[model samples]
Target: MEIRVLGIGCARCNELEKRVKDALAELGIAANVEHVTDLKEIAALGVLMTPGLVIDGKVASQGKVPSKDELKKLLGGGK
Candidate 1:
């Protein structure tokens, strides 16, 4: 799966990326996690938030870092 973390390299953005990786690892799922720091790209996603999580090209969460449990749920829990 393509997991994109959109942010301008802030603390929250880094945290979100790490959490996403942990969640995917816990679920035994291999995913490509990318950090998008480009403003144009982030803006194209229509997110006005600094930290955004995009899973499979769809915006999953924005503005804050979600817990690993929440990320697992957002990823569909391997189902």
Candidate 2:
């Protein structure tokens, strides 16, 4: 799986990335996680807000940092 965190290096963005890792670890899932900081690229992804979360090329969330549990649910098909 591929997970991308889109942000411009803000604290929230960093936190989101960390939570993504934590979620992956908790779920015992391995994924290629990337942090995207380019404005143009983020815009291209249809994210007008920072701290966007993308899972497998699909936009999952944006504009805020979700909690670890929320992230896990999102990663786990909302279960």
For residue 77, give model 1's deviation from the true position in Å: 5.3
- Using lDDT as the measure, the top candidate is 2
lDDT of 1 at 67: 87
| Tens-digit per-residue lDDT, 13-35, candidate 2 | 99999999999999998888999
Model 2 — TM-score against the truth?
Answer: 0.94
In order, the Cα lDDT scores of the candidates are 0.89, 0.92
Q: Candidate 1's C-alpha lDDT?
A: 0.89
Model 1: CA > 4 A from native: 77-79
TM-score of each: 0.94, 0.94
Steric overlap count per candidate: 0, 0
